[model samples]
Target: MKTNQFLFGLKNLDRGQTMKVAIFANDDMTSNIIFAQLFNMSDIQITGLYIAASPRKGTSSIIGGAISLLRRMAFGYWLFLVFTNGAFKVYEFLTLVFRCSPQTGTFYSLRRAAQLRGVRYRKVADFSSPEIAAELQNSNVDLLIIRVGDILQPKILDIPHYGTWCVHSSLLPSFKGIAGEFHALRTKRAPIGSTVFEVTPSLDEGTPLGQVAIQRDETGSVFQHMVNNNIAAGKLLASMVLQAFQCSAPSFELYTPQSQLKSSYHSWPKPDELKVLHRQRKALITPGEAMRLMLAAFRWG
Candidate 1:
């Protein structure tokens, strides 16, 4: 039955009327924001959402759990999460109390937004599962948009008509993997930005679609800059998707190749690196300056 459905979907590809898009993401705030933004677009139809389920803590052995916790703490991840998420939560709460515009970036708020729009959503334990590829095939998805989730295999990557794409939170190939904004902040770098690119079996080596670089505000925390980069990525993805629909064919050839010599991949910071990050926090720009930089980045598009 699934095979027949998949074939039927393929048959309709020649119509090229409206693009069908599917989202692969987690339940984090960034994923929620990307999903909400893509869901509201008129040029593309969001077929379904494939959300990566969090691993069950109870299933892990005591030693494994301890190690995981220790690793996170050693990297100052707990402190980072509290520092970043706390501010957003406070803003959300204040908006509610003041009867102002509700914050839509929260996980629950965006999930509810998706529900209100009558979009189909699902949770999957693995993004590269054959079941997921089958479902996306059956739905006739022309494009796949990945937010904050695991690396996808080629089987899933090749399922969509236009192929898969993702938003990397830094200007690649400079800062390729994980916690890009934090690295930029600690190093006092300029031209902090985001990249929207095609997804490949390789990591962040995919062809670049569009990029937006924001000037670094000297007073902004690493967390605030991270948020701004993500928001900019969401907008850039939307623009790229719209442009894809307007073209005769989705043009993968237009993207520039990433230079490995100039690129660097990063893992999560170590304990000593966290200490450096803490010390460097004093150099971040004020909130007002961060806002100005964010606005400037948006204007670049």
Candidate 2:
């Protein structure tokens, strides 16, 4: 059986009938990678980008933040995230600084992507603000993609004619939270991949438009696996958007009650899970793998 079925038939759209798309994206490498893929698409017109800025930390000290993460994620998993995430940040920073080209395959900022593609980009503090809604209305955005952003309200979601969509890292209606890939790996889930789904008020419970299987290298570092997933997700989402536009009228197949009941949420890994990961001999990220990725990024640029 196929993993996903297109609910609408495909057809060609003329230049004048191009779909106007907007993105609610984050500043991180994952979001930027996804943006790069979408920016390269000539069929859809990218109208605007609403950058989801990181929330302020106020007066919280580094130690306080570390302690809070430790309480929830445990020391082992927390340290793993810090080290790997710090490495990713450094990688992203160097790519933006050195790369003069707007090519794909490297980590770059969303701002950089916008500047290269000549798309309108703005940092969004409050998504529910009337001003934001007005901007979307003025832009005549037909599709709104939530690559990275907070939970959206119905008012904003309803503005897009094709409705709001989200790209989840997992094949949802299953593994519905953060660390979705991690949990899928631990449980040996079959057909691990990404899903482009309709964004509803219920998180990760929306009807899926399509899914593409992404095979992971379990023997490799978690950091590398995550980066690979992000790249695959970007391509999958771009393909989804293209397919949606090709159809005369796009729609999705809702999940049955049994599938809805199977939706499970996973949080950050605990100490026990970390132990199991180690038992599998999967390092968070080896120094060699990090260097290789950086070199690849440089070459791609």
Candidate 3:
């Protein structure tokens, strides 16, 4: 559905009826952007900020960490290597030379931003912890916004009165797992976008509240495309929350059910699969054609 139609027929929140909102995400640029956008919304009362483990430290074991690093290198650097014939090494060297670690800077900036806003900031080792649940309950949060992290437990999901919502980086039901944007790019699929949905026990299986197709930019890198998708997702999430608050129902019920037949799950690609994906992305339709296909697939409600 188009975002406008999805948000139609809902009133804005009544004055003094702010929705208490807590956000969960890692300290990254995407998270920072999401937080900043939500914080600016007048209807949302920012409650707590839960920072998950950094992607650099996502795994507990060395082997797992190595695997994670390889995945990152494959997704981030491999594409460049394919086109530049490994000359991207000089670009990487120059980046290191200039101390241009954008992710690191974004992490610290997020922390500082939270401090300035006086929001309760917690670095959580486990999202499903009883401690976190208790904290949310005590704070009386009306909504929980998950921008990033692992699947949450039912206890965590049930804390918020309005239930938890997540901004997933893929069109609902389809591409419902890790590296969704990469998977979409690899498949050369159109209507590649983001979904804002109610968080359920199942991963990305909740009813979608809003969705927006991302405009593809062929000139950009994979990382840039992912960031663009995330930003659009975050904005749609904020819009959903605002519209829900305007609803007259005691519990927010503004949602569109996803199709079971159309939905599919994805996982991290294997090394061979990654090579195939790289080849597919390199050989796929141009950005203009991709955008046209995406628009054609976008069915307005």
Candidate 4:
């Protein structure tokens, strides 16, 4: 949708209607950026947070999560993930020990971000727990914003009066599942995009509350593009939440259900797909970019 169309439906909130919001997310660099945007909001109260240990279900422990990954993909790719995650975890540890603020565009864990915001958070194995549902009800949560891999159960979904919404990294009715941005990159989608949608039982097939797309940078690496896309998604989510809180609904003009469109759902990128990216001369992550990111995550002081 165009920028004007997105803004056309926004209405200012009355003084007494502050939304009590909760967040469900994975504790990663991208989530940290997203959480920062929410924490900065002055109007709504963030009632609670659920930071999943892993995006996957049934395997929240280090050992169980690793085993789950191996079951889904090749061992080689799992090793690649281990190394990549290890590096980020080390940076998170450093930030904690040193007590430093993350530099702009740098990585930080969601836990650190929560601490900085002074918001209490809970680490959960998955989102299906009755206990979590009870907590949301007890907190009088008005809305639930989710950016996790676990599919929520109806009990959890029913806790929030306004229902759960998700921040997705691709234009809905196009790339609808995991790594949508990656799929867009490999498929050469001209302008990559992000969507904020109402989460239903169907994966990514909810009503799109807001969306924005950008022209892909031809010169950037795949990792760079993905990171930038996620950052955009984070900002987009914050804006949508504010709009929803103010008006009690996203502008009716913006409500397009995914079922009405030719939406495609994607799973994890296969090994051949990764090879195809390389064949197209696209580097997933340049070593220089990785090193620069690591250095920026640390406090020089």
Top lDDT: which candidate number?
4
Q: What tens-digit string does per-residue lDDT give for candidate 1 at 1-301?
A: 0011122333344445778888877545555554556766787788887665542233233234334645544445544544343444444344445544323332223444445566677766678878888898899888888864367788888888767778877777777876777776676543577877778887788767667766676666765676677777777677667656665333322223344225777776667767777776543335664454334322311
What does candidate 4's lDDT look like per residue over 33-99, in tens digits? Answer: 6666777788888887788876467666755676777766544445545655565677778877776
How do all models score by TM-score? 0.73, 0.79, 0.69, 0.85
Candidate 3: 10-residue stretch with minimal lDDT: 292-301
1 or 4, greater by lDDT: 4
lDDT of 2 by residue, 210-274 (tens): 66556767676666666777787887777668767777354332233334335677877887987
The stretch of ten residues in a row with the least summed lDDT in candidate 1 is 1-10
Question: Which candidate should be chosen as best, given TM-score against the real structure?
Answer: 4
User: Quick one: RMSD of model 4?
Assistant: 4.1
In model 2, which regions exceed 4 Å deviation? 1-15, 55-71, 75-99, 189-191, 248-262, 293-301
Clashing pairs in 4: none
Q: Per model, state how many residue pairs clash.
A: 7, 0, 0, 0
Cα TM-score of candidate 1: 0.73
Off by over 4 Å in 4: 1-14, 74-84, 102-104, 248-262
